[model samples]
Target chain A: MSEKLKRFASNNKQLLIMIGVIAVVFIILSLTVPSFATIRNLTNLLQMIAPIAVMACGATYVLVIGGMDISNPSVMAASAVFGVYCMTTLGVNLVLGTIIIILTGAFLGLINGFAIAKLKMVPMVVTLSMMTIGTGLATILSGTRGLPRLPDSFSEFFNKTAVIIILLAVMLIMDFILTRTKFGRKLYYIGNNARTTKVSGIDSESIIMLTYVISGVCAGIAGVINTASIGTARANMGPQSQILDIISAAVIGGVSTSGGSGRVRDAVLGAFLVCGLTNVMNLLNVSDYYTTLIKGGIIIGAMGIASFRQQQAAKKGV
Target chain B: MKRILAIVLALVMVFALVACGQQAAPAGGSNQSTSQQGSAGSPKQDIAEAAPAEKPAETELKHVKMGLAMQSLQAAAFHAWADYLAYRLDYEAEQRGYEVELVTLNADNDVTKQATDIRDLIAQGCEVIFCPCLDSQAILSSVKEVHDAGLIYVSYCREVSHDAQGDEVPDLTVNFASEEQAYAGMVDLFNIMKEDGVEPVKLIDCYGDKTDENAHNREHGLRRAMEEFGYADLPVVEVECGHWEPDVCGQNLAPVLAANPDANCMYSSSDFLNSGIQKAMEDAGMWHKHGEEGHVYFSASDMYPLGIQHLREGYMDTAVDQGCYNFAVHAAAGAFDLLEGKEVEPVQLVLGTQATYKDIEEILATIPLWGNDYADY
Candidate 1:
C-alpha cells in the first residue's frame, strides 16, 4: 500500500485529490439533500454539466499548453446563432446546420490557434480580442435580435440523456488524444517545455494550434447544446457566464495556469463540481448575489489548497 | 448707382412700416410675428402643413439636441418597442416642423460602452437625453451632467432620482406605469382563471430581476391577485430567476415543483420566463396533469404571440398583454407634445390588453403593430 501510495503520488496526486474532494462534497451534499441521490436528479445534473464540461476539457488543453481561450463562449454564441439561422431561415436540415455550426467554431478556433502559435501573441489578449470579434459577428449574423423559431425536434436533443452520453464519449476521445496517441505525448512535452520539445524534433506550434481547434470544436458543441437547452439563440445570452465561471472551474479542477500539468478528466470533474455546487446552492435558497460570492470563495479555497499541495510536492521533490 | 439707391429706399420704407406697426400694437395684443402674417385666411395653417417653413432669419435660437440611447435589440419584443418609438418621433417631427432631430444610439448591452456612449452624446451637445438603462446606475453619472446642463432628462424604463428640497418625487420618470401594467395583467389573469371555475388554485409564483421596477411590479401584481381573488389563504411558492431567460426560469421551476408538486397554477413575470416553466413541465412529463385538472396552468404579465400560441397548443393558460408597441407610441407622442408645445399629462401611461388563446390569433395578423422592420437599426 505504501508503494502504491508513492506511485500514485508521483503520477496522479492532483487527480486523486480532485476525486477525493468531489466525493466528499457529493457525500455531504447527498446526506443533506435527499433528492440529490435520485437518478432523475443526477441525470438532470449530468445533462446540465456535460456541455460546459466538454468545453472545459478543451479549455484544459489550452491552459495546459500555457494559453487561455476566453474566445470559447463568444465563438459558441456565434456558431449557435449560425446554426439556428441555417435551421430556420435558410431551411436546412438540422444535422447540416449542426455541422455548419461546428465547422464555424472549428474555423474560429483555427484562427485563435494560428494567431497565438504562429504570431506569438499573448493568449490572454488574443482570446479576449477574439471574444469581442466573435460576439459582434454573432450579433450581426443573428440580425441583432436573436435567431428564433428553432424547430421542436432540434431542441429534443438537449432534453434527452443522449447529450450527456455524447459529451462523455467526446471527453473519452479527448482523453485518448491527450494520453495514448503520439500527438498526445508530444502535447505534454510541448506544454512542459516548448524549447525542449522543439529541440527534440516535435512541432510545438502544430500541437498548440490543434489544441485551439479542439477548444473551438468544443465551444461549438457547447453552443449548440446551450441553444437546445435554452430554446433560444441570443448572441449575448449570459454575457458574463464564461469569464465568471469557466476560468474558476478550470483552475480549481487542477488545470494549472503554470501549464504542462492536468487531465481532461480533471477539467470534467471540475465542471461537474461547479454544477453540483450551483444545484446545492439553489436548493439552499441562496441569493444569486451571495451565490456568486460563495462560488468565488470556493474557487479561491480550491486554488489555495492546490497550491499548498504543490508546495509540499516540491519540498519532497516529487 | 441709381438702382442701388432705389432698393435701399424701398427696404427703409418697409422697415419704417414694420416699426410703425410694432409701435401701434398693444402689449400682448398679438402672438404672431410680422413674418408669420403672409396669409390671413388659415392659409398660414396650410403653409405650416405643406412646407418646411424657413427658419426665422435669426441665427440665435440655441439648438437643443437630445440623444436616445438603448441597450440592445436582442429581444424581438424590445425591438418592436424601440422601433415604434423612433418612428413616431421622426414622423411627428416631419409633420410638426420642429428643429428637433433624434440621434439614435445602440449600446448592445455593454454597461461600460453605454456609459461612454452617453458621454459622447453629451459632448455632442445633447440638451435632453433619454435612456432605457441597462442595470448599473452608477454608470449614469452622465445623466446627472445632462440634468446639470439644465437639459430635460428622463430614463425611459428605469426611474432616476434627484436630491430635492425635502420632497421626493421621481426625478426622471420612466414612460411605462410599472404598477398599473403589472397589477392590471395579474388581476386580469387571475380573474380569467377564477371565472373558469378553478377554485383553490395553488400558485407557484416566479419573477424576473428584483432590481428592475417592471419585474418588481410583476411580482407585487401576483401578490395582489392572490390577495384580491380570495386566494389569500392559498399556498404560494415564490422564486426570482433574474432575467426572462428560459433556462433560468426552467431551473427555478424545478425546485418549486419539488417543493409544491401539487401546485395547480404557475405565474411568471414575463412570457419568456413562462415559456421556460412550460418547457420544464413538459420535459418532466407532468404537463398533461396541468390540463387534465383544468386547474394547472401558467400565467404571466407581458404577453407575446408565442405565449398565445402555447396557450392554443394547450401548453399555457393566460398571459397579460402589455402592448409594448403601444407603450412606445405613447412615449413618442409625449416627446412630440413636449417638442411642439402641445399639452401632455406629466404622469406615466399604462397600456395593456388581456387575451386568451381563442382571441390572440387575431392580434397576430396586424403585423405592423408587432412585426420587425429593422428600420431603426
Candidate 2:
C-alpha cells in the first residue's frame, strides 16, 4: 500500500499541487468572506464552472496530441445557435436538436483535423480560420437577434444537476479512454514523437485527426449546456474571453501545452481551481481589475512551480 | 480519401438541414423589405392620415430606403431599441404611402465591421443611414462616404467625431441627455437616503464601460449631481468600472461591500450593472428594499424591463428611461425631413424621462419596456 501510494503521488505531483492550491484558496476565502464556504455558494460555483469544465475535457485530448484549438468558443457559439434554431423554430425534438448541435461541432472539428492531418497545415492557423468561419456562419443563421427563449421543459430536463452529472460522466469516460485504450496510447506516442510512431508502423495522422474530432464533440456538448443554462442561444454566445479561461484552467490543471503529457482528470482539477478563484474573489467583493491581476499572478506562480518541479525531476532522473 | 469524402458529405447534410429548418419557420420581424402600395390619393390626404405632419408633396417622398447600423444586439436593451425603431419606421412609411426598404445590420461591437456595414448600406442604395457607431472616430470615413453619396447621415445614441479634414458632418444627431439623466437619478436616490436618516452617506459609484461615450457622459452627470447636492466631497467608499456587464459589476462590488459593510447607497450607470450590485449585496447580507432596515439606496439608468421590475419591487430608488420610442420617432422624423429637403432644425436632439418607485406604473404605461413585443408597440 505504501509503495502504491508513493507511485500515485509521483505520477500526479502537479495535480496534487493544484489540489493543494484550491484547498488553500477555499480556506482563505472561508475565513475572510462570510458565507463563502456555504453549500449554496459552492453549488452556484459548480453550475458556473460546468460549461468550461466540459470543454476542458476535450481540450485535454487536443493538448495531449500536440495541437491547439483556439476556436472552441466559436464552435460552441455555432453549435448552440444551430441547436436552438432546430428546437425552437423547426420544432425539432429535444433529442434531435441535441444531436444536431454535437454534429455541427464534430463537422467543424473534422475540418480542422483534415487540414492539419491530411493537408499538412498548421493547427493554430487552421483552427483560427475555422473559428472565423464558424462565427460568421452562426451570425448568418441566427442573425444579430439570437434564438428566443427555449421551451421550459427542454431547459428543465437539462437542469443544473443534469449538467453536473453529464460533466462527471464525460470526465470519467475520457480518463478511462486515455489511460486504458489502444487509441489513447497511440495519441501519446504520436505526440511525443510522430516520426518514431510512424517508423513503428502506427498510423499517427489518423489518431491525431480523431483527437480533434473528440475535441469538437466536447465543444458541441458545452454549447448545448451553455444554451440551457442561459436559456437563449446568442450569436456571440461563446466570447473569446471565456475560451481563455478554459485554456488557462487546462494548463493550470497540468495539461502541458507542449503536448504528449497530461491526464483527462487534470483538466477538471484545473477548471475547479480557476472557478474557485473567481468565486472566492467575487464573494470577497474584490475589484475585477484587481481580481484579473491576482488571477494572472497565480497562473504564473503555478506555472513557475511546475517548471521548477520538472527541473528537479530531470536532475533526479539523471 | 473515403474518410475525407464522408466528412464532406456530412457537412453538406448539416447545411441542408439548416436551410430546411429556416424555410419551415421564418424568423420574426427582421428588418427586411415589405412591399406596400402607395395610397392613390392627394398628398394632403396622405399627410393627414399620418401623425401630426407638415405635408410634403407625394412626389418628394422618393421611395426612401433607410439603413440602421447598430453597435451590437448582445444587450437586450439595444436589441429592443433596434427592433422598435425598425417597426416604427415601417409603420410610418406605410402610413405616408411610400415604398420603404429598411436594412438593419449588427456590427457585433467591432468598429471595423461597423464601418464596413455602413459602406454596404450605402452600396445597397440606402437614401438615409442611421448608425449608433461602435467607434466615433473610426467611423468618420464611412460617414464621409455617406455624405459624398448625397445620402442623409443620422447619428444615433453616440455622436460621431468630425475628421480634421473637415469632411461633411452628420446631417442630424439624436441622443438622450445621458449625463443629466444619470445625475438626476443619483440625486433622487441621495434624497431618499437623506430622508431615511441615513446620515453621512457612503456611496459606491458603479460606472459603465469606459470605452462608451455615454459612460463618460453619465459619469460627468453623476459628478454634477454630487456637486449640486453638496455631496461633491462625500465619502465615495468605492468606485467600480462595471463595463456594462452584470458579472463584472458583481465581481467589482463584492470586495467593496466587504470593506464598507455600512455603505448606504450605490449609483450604477445602468440597470444591467445594478442587477449585479443587487446580487452581490444580497449575498453579502447587505441588501434591503427601501423602507426596510439596512436598505441600500440604488440609482440607475436605462429603465429596461429588469430595471422597471426592480422599481416595482421597491429594490431601486430611481431609474432614468432613455425613451426608445421617442428616439425612434425623432430619428425617423429627421430622416423624412432630410429626404424631402424640408428645413432641418437644431443638429442635436436630446430626449429622456426619469422614473421612481412612486410613479413606476405611470412610466411603464407611457414608455416601451425592454423585451416589449413589436405588436404591443
Candidate 3:
C-alpha cells in the first residue's frame, strides 16, 4: 500500500501539491468566512460551479490537444441565443431547440476546428476572432435582446440537482474519452509533438478537428443547462468571464496549458477551487477586485509550484 | 473508433432534424412558470400595460434572510445599492426586532450567472430577492422560480414584464431608472444655467454605447429637454462610443474633445462616465470649476460618488440621480412587507431627484444618497 502510494505520489507530484494548496484554501475559507463550510453554502457553491466546470471539461480537450479557445464566451452566448431563438421564434419544440443550440456550438467549433486544423491558423487568434463574431451573431439572432419565455425543457436538464448531474456526466464522458479511447491518445500525441504524431502515421488533423467538435458539443450542453436554469437566453451569458475561469481551472487542476497531459476530473477540481474563492469572498463581504487579484496570485503560485516541481525532478534525474 | 464517432454524430444530427419536425405537432406540455425576453435586451413594454402578476400560489418564506442581487458592481451605483440595501435591511431588522441576514451577489452583466446567483441566494435561505433586472425578459422565469420556491422576488426597472402578458407570476417591480429621471435633470440644469448666468446653453450630447438602452433613454431625455428649451435643431456631433466603462469612456472622449475645441455644455448618458469626461476635459485645458473659464456645462444621469462630488464642488452642472439608493431603500422595505405576509404594491415608484450644485445640498437634506451615507464602506 505504501509502495503504491509512493509510486502514485511520484507520478503525480503536481496534482498532489495542487490538492494540498486547494485543501489549504478550503480550510482557511471555512475558518474565516462564516458558513463557508456549511452544507448549504457548499451545495450553492456546487450549483455556482456546475456550468463553469462543465465548460472546463470541454476546454480540457482543447488544452490537452495543444489549443486555446477564448471564443467560448461569445460562442456560448451565440449558440444559446440561436437555440432559444429557434425554440421561441422559429417555433421549435424544446428538444429541437436544445439540439439546435448544441448544433450551433458544433458548427462554430467546426469553423474553429477547420481554421486551426485545415488552414493552420494560430489557435488563440482564430478563437479570439471567433469570439467577437459569435458575440455579434448572438446579438443579431436575438436582435440584441434576451430570448426568454422558453418552453419546458425536453430533457432532464433543469433544476439545481440536474445541472450538477449534467456536470458529472460531462466530466465522466470527457475523462473516459481522454483516458480510455484511441481518440484521446491521438490528441495527446498531437499536443505532445505534431511532427512525431505525423511520423507515427496518425491522422492528427482529423482527430484534432473532431476534438474541437466534441468541445463544441460540450459547450452546447452547457448552453442548454444555462438556458434552462436561467430561463432566458441573452447575447451575453456566463461564459464572458467564465472562459477565463475555465482556463484557470484547467491549469490549476494540473492540465498543462502548454499542451500534453490533462484530465477532465482535474479540470473540474480546478473549477471548484477557482469558484470557491468567489463564493467565500461574497460570503465574507470581501470585494470582487480582491478575488480577481487573489485568483491571479493563485494561478501564478500554481505555475511556480509546477516549475519548482520540474526543477526538483530534473535535479534528482527523475 | 472513427466509425463509432461517425455513427454517434449521424445519430445526434438525425435526432435534431426529427425534433425540428416534432415542434409543429402538439407535444406533451409541462406546466411551466418561467418567462422570456420582451424586446432587444431592455424591457420594451410600457409599465402601464403590464397587469399585476398574481403572486406565486401559496408560496411562503422559508428563511429569515434577505438578498440583493446587482447586475454588476463595476458601476459605482450598484455598489451603492448593495451597501444601502444592507444598511436598510439592518435598520428594518432593528425596527422589527428580528434579524434578517443579507446575501448580496453581482452577476457582472451575465444573465445566466444572475440565475445561478439567484439560486445561491435561495440556497442561502433568503426569503426575498431584489435585483435591478439586467434583462427584463430574461428574468421572468427566475421570478417564477423564486415564487414557486415559496419566496418573494422583487425587481426594479423591468422592460419585459411577464405580468404584462398576464402571467400568474407575482413579482413586484420598482419603477426606478427611467427616462423621466433624465428629463427632470435636463429641465433642472437649464433653470440652474439661467440662474448662474450660463443661460442659452448650447448642448453637446456625449453618447454612450449606441446599442445600449440607457444611452438612448438619457439621450432622448436630453433631446426632449433641448426641444423644450428651444435648441432642438443642434447638429448632433458623433462621439466615440465608450460602452459605459471608465477606461474606454475616457479613451473614446479624447478625440471628441480634440475635434470640438470650443464645444460647450456636454450632456452625457450617465455621470458614471464622469471619470472619462473629466480626464478628457482636464487634458484639453477645458476642465474648470463652475464660473471658471473653459468650464463646459456637464450634466448626466446616476449621480454616483464622483458625480455628487462634481456637483457639490461646482464642477458639474447637473446629475440626474436615478434614485438608486431610494429604490434600494424602498425595495428593502418591500421585502420586509412581503416577509411579514403584508400586502404590498406591485409597482412601487421612487421619484429621482435632479440635483445641481445649487440644489444638491438641499436635496441631500431630504434624500439619502447611498454614496454619501456609505462612502466609508
- Can you give the TM-score per candidate against the true fold? 0.49, 0.52, 0.75
Model 3, A12-42: lDDT tens digits are 6555655655666566556655566777677
Scored by lDDT, the top model is: 2
Judging by lDDT, tell me the better candidate of 1 and 3: 3
Q: List the residue pairs that clash in candidate 2.
A: A285-B254, A285-B255, A286-B255
Kindly list the per-residue Cα lDDT of model 3 for residues B58-145, writing each as its tens digit: 2332326767677787765666566556655654554555566665677787777777677667666678888766666667666766
What local lDDT score does residue B198 receive in model 2, on the 0 to 100 scale? 73
What digit string (tens of lDDT, one per residue) describes model 2 on residues A218-261? Answer: 98998888776545465556766666778877887777677777
Which candidate do you rate higher for DockQ, 2 or 3? Answer: 3
Q: Per-residue lDDT for B176 in model 2?
A: 70
What are the clashing pairs of model 1? none
Q: How accurate is candidate 2 locally (lDDT)?
A: 0.71
lDDT of 1 at B33: 26
Go through the candidates in order and give each one's C-alpha lDDT: 0.62, 0.71, 0.69
> Which segments of model 2 are wrong by more than 4 Å?
A1-66, A69-193, A197-318, B1-61, B95-97, B148-150, B161-165, B237-242, B365-377
Share of native interface contacts present in candidate 3: 0.35
For model 2 chain B, give the 10-residue run with minimal summed lDDT: B34-43
Per-residue accuracy of model 2 over B1-377 as CA lDDT, tens digit each: 32233234333323332333233211114523222123221122333456545645667664867878888776766765675566666556755666575666666564434654565566556799998876554455567668877788888777765331345478887777788878889888777767776764688878666545677788898889888888888878645553367887888888898899877877888886666777888889987777888878888888766777788889888988766656676777777777778867635545456788888887556444442322222
| iRMSD, model 2, in Å | 23.3
